[model samples]
Target: MAFTFQINNELQFNHDEELLKKAEECCPEIKKETKKALHLVKLIQDQTQLDGIGTSILEKDIDQLSDYHLKRDDSLILDFGNHYVGSFSVDLDQVGSPMDAPLYIRLKFAEMPCELNAESQDYDGWLSRSWIQEEFIHIDELPYTLKLPRRYSFRYVEIKVIDTSPKWQVVIKNPTLITETSADYSRLEPLSLEDKTLQKIYDVGLKTLADCMQDVFEDGPKRDRRLWLGDLRLQALANYSTFDQCELVKRCLYLFAGMTAENNKISANVFVKPKPLPDDTFLYEYSLFFISTLYDYNKAHPDLAFVKELYPIAKKQMDVTLKMFTEEGKFIPDEDYPVFVDWSNAFNKDTAGHAETIYVLKQFISLSHLVEDEDEHIYTKALNQLSNYAKEHLFNKEKHLFVTGENEYNIASQVWMVLAHVMDDETNKKIMNNTIEQLFPIKNIATPYMYHHIVEALFEAHLDKEAIALMKKYWGKMIELGADTFWEAFDPDRVSYSPYGSPIVNSYCHAWSCTPVYLIKKYILNSK
Candidate 1:
């Protein structure tokens, strides 16, 4: 009764043996995996130490402290190695439950493989290397023995452990400053439940992404057109706050290539002809962005050998895009096979080709950065061409905002102009700000691609605070309205659409929207 046919669309669980038997005929592996996951979930629940601690700290305990803006909690403790991190509350007026008393806390490790490696895709990989919280809590019953160093200030309590891990970037923000000296505790704070809960959700998202990509690889690219999916997977990973999580994305790409010529476009083993060489400009553009993100990972963590392995693939893809530049001096969007041609569709622009051209060229610029051996003059020329075109056609000196292409300008076109400036500073920075100002006043509007351009532009301009505020205000609203995941647009009314049905735009758990959730979670929350 808990799960009927309609309710369980995925058929994730079905106790009916007869139905299970019939379903097993079609996807035995799926049924088996589902059952295994269910079993694992149950087992993990029983084993997690945090589960016990969480039970003790009822929803009531949290509610009582809600008014205090309790940022750091020092009473609770988690022993990782020779250090401990936990949450505690503040009694500013010295009037609250457990007031003026030092609370002792300790937690045992609930899961094995306490450390994560970039290449490993196991469950533990999602655990935060520095400050990870688990579903289990096992609070100790020891009485507080330490005396208060300063009365009416803070009664410091220390939780000690012996960490066997090689590195400790994890930190406790508060009480540890008074009690411990081994690990850093500068950025620690008592995380809100919403934040804690959301972090877990993102970890699941990370795990889901990893599993999906592995399946795409296992199924082979020929059947799934995995290049697009791979690009999406890595993009999602790139949005993660932790450096280690980002490395996982690069490692997966490397694993998929398996020492094959990193440059050649690959299809899953299931494909008939290996994706037919990506004979279109879109393929080059899309692949280039992915390559650039990987390059960034390599630049930051040079020890990641997989990034080096991907260099050839990156160089080859760049060459394909660069070759598309015409002998007559224009980069044409046209391609022979045209596997992934996209025209700006979300918002009105002046002209399709005009606006689309700027978008493509900017992506190419990002691609240029990923390929180290490439000449600066090559991309410099492309940047100049795009900037000149924008200045001539899109710049509106009077309004200070860039005008849309041949058609009326809308959110989508502004996004393109903003991104172009961010990528190639050849364009006027004033125009980028102008576009952002016009777009900001428009309420309840969000396009996944447009948001990306805005964030990228703001970050480039060092407007981190404004960017965070914008994402939280507009995009954050979208998240509140049942965004189980991010959506393509702001769907306050929950409108649905179909791209093929004469521009019927609606929602059904789109991919672009999901990107926003990844971004906000990574940047604002900075969750591990």
Candidate 2:
């Protein structure tokens, strides 16, 4: 329940059977499709492609995949044409002389070609090497099906022979990925748009969301398959606008509510496999976002019964987070429970965190009214205090921007404050204009999640052209760099930046980056 759970296993959660049962009942049946390898390709250095790695489609036909024979040290790469979350398998047979030695091979699954450039053994990042999506196997017999049990999120699978024997070679054929997803692409209603770029951005964004959808709305199927609260908030918004899969959103909400700590503090994320369990990770804004997620869900697909069912758990998040703020309405960043404004801690987050609190408190108060919580005034007062503090203390009138630690004015501070609507309409526009003039050509900050906030803030300030331009610049650049789907982090200035010290660990199709669909639907399509 507290930070003590880090060292001691004193953490215990209340598993409401009814809520957990509803979560189980709402688990969407995972749909699967058998996809054959589309083309054979070789990875080569190309400056134009992502991470300076591009694929040259081999002349060989995928229909005759077995025709190619590989000797020891030979490797083959199969391009599946599109991104998918699934398990991979291929028929492996021996060629020439009798099977002498065991067939030792390494299979590396990559979401991007650049990831193939990163050697798993060379990956020295802080993230677990287990998440590299590489597997080493030894086959004692010939004519092996070689069906890997582990599911992988990838479009390229590289098979490298370590040693098959000097006498014989290996024949690879029938490479197939049993794709998994709970999202129904057929359910997407077709729409007409004039701007091709925005249309493409929305399409790619939808694909990104679909790829990440599973038993739960996973942040990244390739990596942290856990259901993160922060990702859930954004994914729910996008889902409402796109697939409209309310059951999945409700399942996710109930899961978070069902697995809360004894103190009713929701875990930042939850592990869904081997039975559902919550992780010890807790973020300040993430926990508070539970209320926001529920509020958005209700607005998109209203169900008072559902709102009432989860109201107490949602209310607890606001109640718990309000304690993090001081009597003076200043948010104190706790080392044990830090605010995750972005993955990068490169900037001061107190003001952004304070603004974020105002953002969630407003949502909490709205939900409080829906369920008729009599103590709604408590949340309203807290929201007023947080907003008043930001307007009075955090703003820099001279710069027309919000300042954080050491008098630093960052993009996040302004974006979240605008999203919170802490300032009036005219002031919000000035803040965004100043943010664009002073903070143009954004650098160091990477994460489509933050980019989504900035773009939405721009749109909210009635800067549609600026919003569209920024979206095209940031998200469109990912498309130019050969993103079949949007990436988790991309600072255009440093195209090769990775939080995990290697591009191999970066999520190319993350859920947080899928908000362009929501943004487009809300701002552009629904524009006056």
Candidate 3:
């Protein structure tokens, strides 16, 4: 996820020790399982695979890994059979004469085969190179278990003997990955779907969520492993339907509530390692999501006291968001805290931002009632003012679609407006039908985050057929392109497009993309 990286050093933040202590109280124990390398594989050029790269399993038996003695330049790739978040270790022994030189080896970890094909040196994107999962090691002694100290999210590991003197070759064996996650898959009841494709999509989406369910819901286990308020909202939704790990969600809520700017603004994301520090980066919608998350949590789990405790933080968020609107309810977005509808800047988000305000404002009002806030009546008026402004100025009745800056009609504006219930049911259906006729084949836009909103809008408009088809067409395409899990960015128009100019930094298993679990359970199962 290549977000706008901004650091505001002058921003003063508050750290509520009580909230932090509660977060610590809710911390989950890391669940783990050991997995062995299933096969030895060869990376090959294949058009069928994603990024024009695929893996071919070698006939060599994994049990006899030590048979293939590795000398200078000899290399092998170990297939872990599935993607996992954890550490890897392999036993190494000297198979030749006395070891004349220290064994220098290079290990490259890949979530997918294409990542292995992409040369790390060629990646000069905005993301830090240190996040790249590749390491070079020099082993001075023999008969050592090469246990990588750092955790990795991957399905494949390529090991190369940079130099093992002709005197003795290095023998490798017992390659194992200790997988880690806080999600309990055993809790899920077996789901039987008539459509096999939807079943696969659901399973993949579940795995995507499971892998990212660490101590806190990480946006991506491979990169940006932190609790993002926006991502947490979706992850918590999916978790409620599947893992039902409400405590993790509660902990994440406190983590954000514990650290906020003095203006009552929550950070876009927070790092939990060493100490919980909110990111300096901020986004318009992400901060508002704190209220949405708290609201959703109350809906799913329903604890009046829990809601009461977090209500003030959620209200503070709503307060900050309310300031962006004019007395007439016009939303003038600030550049410093831009509304991130998606990673793409190709489309204007003026109308969508306004609609999101309505979406979260409604959520906040519901929360306000539960907490008995005296200021609750104020938001009820603001909601009407916002909805009125949208219907009067933003919605183009003639075109039957919402308009953004420069009269640019886009999918995001319609999706968010539909979600916010800016109009009556009939009007929503009409707007969505118009959207389908004009924007059937989604292009330029990617990010499952945005795709989720579009699919949800279709469902909200009662266009079940269109909604399922879009889900199949967009997310199914990811499965077709070899997705073990969903991606952070994907554009069917440009299948290989990466926001950071390289697929290496693209997050394959992302939090926002894993909502199929919630969608399937909420829409499909409930319909039946």
* Model 2 TM-score, 2 decimals: 0.97
Ranking by TM-score: 3, 2, 1
Output the better candidate (2/3) by lDDT. Answer: 3
Reference-based lDDT, residue 337, model 2: 82
State the local distance difference test value for candidate 1: 0.35
lDDT of 2 by residue, 467-527 (tens): 9999999999999888988988888888998888999899998999999999999999889
lDDT by candidate, in order shown = 0.35, 0.90, 0.90
Model 1 alpha-carbon miss at residue 120, Å: 39
- Which consecutive 10 residues in model 2 have the weakest lDDT in total? 1-10
Clashing pairs in 3: none
Q: TM-score for every candidate vs. truth?
A: 0.45, 0.97, 0.98
* Candidate 1 minimal-lDDT segment of 10 residues: 31-40
Worst-scoring 10-residue span by lDDT in model 3: 1-10
- Estimate the overall C-alpha local distance difference test score of candidate 2: 0.90
Candidate scoring better on TM-score of 2 and 3: 3
Off by over 4 Å in 3: none
